[model samples]
Target: DHTHLKKALVFTNSRTDAEETILEMRRMAAKRGERDVFHVHHGSISAMLREETEAALRQGPGPAVAAATLTLELGIDLGELERVLQLGAPYSCASFVQRLGRSGRRGDAASEMIFVTPEEEDEEAQLPARMPWTLLRAIAVIELYVREKWVEPLNVRQLPVGLLYHQTMSILKSMGEAEPEDLKEAVLSLPSFRGIDPADYDAFMEYMIGMGHIETMEEGTVLIGLAGEKIVNNFRFYAVFKDDEEHVVYNGTEEIGSITTVPPPGYCFTLAGKLWKIEEVDTRHKAVYVKSSRGKVDTLWLGAGGDVHTRIMAKIREVLGSTALYPYLAPSAAARLERARRLAKESGLLTSEVLPAGGDSMFILPWAGSRQFRTLERLLKNNLKGRLGLRSIVPMEPYYMVVAGRTDAETLQEEIIA
Candidate 1:
């Protein structure tokens, strides 16, 4: 708690983590007699609240902590922050570096980041649980940046059909009406839509027209239809990314933030680093009214995992294979890594791709990225299942897959080779 008074930005991977983490932080702050010190910021929150949180962090006379996701990771100037805290392993080295750059922006001060990797307490540990995956990943990311100056390359999406459609609707909505050729030129002139085929766009426009999203006048001009107008007129239409329907949470008349779902009356929920008891649910306006309450409540938010590069996975494998200890690791973390390395050595996982997992089960270490691992899984289940006598195939994703089959390790490996 030495840095409790230091202004910091606590980064989480998702909105749910941001909410929960802020709640926990607020609880701890309350014990220290701190009030209105913790704030929450994420995409789901209202723009006004997010701006307020940004302002709080940027020009605070006293220490104020903001628990946030990537929404606060880059772009905004939060002044000179004393520290950056990451809740879990960041998905990429680029992300790690971007977050690390948030601190120590003034003068010659060195940037500081404190990674908090939470370990699960399981009485009966599973094979995956035995290894410190999060710790290893955090180490690998740091090493990759420090040692090799390597960051995962950005993989830009090629065919952004959704963005294209969004732009089309926006253009039509703004221009009111235009000839098909003029509309085509206007939409396709944008750099993002440069790769899109004109013929394909025509086909898409025809489909949209048929679906009532656009209308064609007798004069051969195109305009936004009632359906498209409904979409274009909404505030959310500006965003091209997929957004889930969320209910706005309000403290009396003041808007707190938005969540994916609203609880019924008498239910308690968390938002913007504070707990509230649901007094009423406004279904028509998609809002929730609440009053300040104590204790704890968990709220659900939708999240998805990001893709891990094969290079990072290879670095993880190297970390497991080597005996070199990372200086940044604490004693407990070093001990945990030692145990994991010992297990890896004993199970021959470092050198071998296949390892025995108790009776009638074996592990296949693909050491590939998510997409590659999924492809290998399909190959095992669809193509190699019968040949290898595989009964059940379960994947832990982007890592090793466990399969329970009749065939032995040697036979399974040999069969896989064939």
Candidate 2:
């Protein structure tokens, strides 16, 4: 049963998925009469718990596995891991490589990763539903990285005004007091601020002073003001992005974690890889009291999805169109791909870019990527809506555009070309 893999890391896309996966893992362990060795590590979880999980994986006597989001993607030593597992396709080849590098760290053993992608099967589902988008994405990511040695290119932020403000406040706080010219020089000398013009810097300083974030003395020196001091002294100041007002959770005397919303008493939720039943809600203090819970509960949390590159989208299209077999696919995955390919060919998706959907609807497949898809979507909704007598428009991004209207294919083509 591969018991030699005593330590492993399970990477997921979001915090909610990580928590849910660990909860399932604990359930499976409980059924086996084994110790619950699963833990969760994410940004929302307390740093102390995360560090403790890391230490447990490094030194715990028994088996240990941690389900985590991007919090564990970066460099953090957890000794030598025997396995690395991913729930679905990673956002990019760079992410794939980073997660893969975490395993098989002993001696000359090569790193390895296992991808566990789940696909739904429905007898009455549509053609698009049958297509294995996640599988295709995984193949594209792997082929692009392994065969072409190509990873998504980095795009540096052109305007980072928030970071500029943070750096300015931090420098002023450290310096206590600095001349106006000295402060400007100190903030602008950083490499991140090299593109900023002196005039722009001066304007930002004026704005800060106007907002009472900085104060000027008779000696022509600038110092952090009361407002700026309040911001700089907070523990959350180190984060570049704004965090939501969160309520802390406590399990009896032990601190658990924080969440954005607090449900009324008697709601069960999952946190830190364990279920918790809410006993009391202290709205004034913004603290939640909970005890251990065994019942299943569905909890929702806010998170952002990763952006798909145009290249990766094109690669997915290629995978869909081509008949080449991928050896990495399991038997079930291979069978799913075969079914999708058969259905795609029969539906004329391989030859025609436009297909009629029932009486008045049509699907326009541009075979383009995210940016191109966005442009086409805008054109249909904004420019050609009234001209085509369009009744409705549905956009499935980076894939196809479906519109129901009285216009025929010929006129639609003419309008789109024009």
User: What does the lDDT come to for candidate 1?
Assistant: 0.84
Local accuracy of candidate 2 as per-residue lDDT tens digits, 250-317: 98877888999778889999999889999999999989999998886766586755756778877877
Model 1 residue 110 CA deviation (Å) reads 1.3
Model 2, which residues run further than 4 Å from truth? 1-5, 159-240, 350-354, 364-418
Top candidate (lDDT): 1
Please give the range of 10 consecutive residues that has the lowest summed lDDT in model 1: 120-129
| TM-scores for every candidate against the unseen true structure | 0.79, 0.78
- Candidate 1 vs. truth: CA RMSD? 4.9
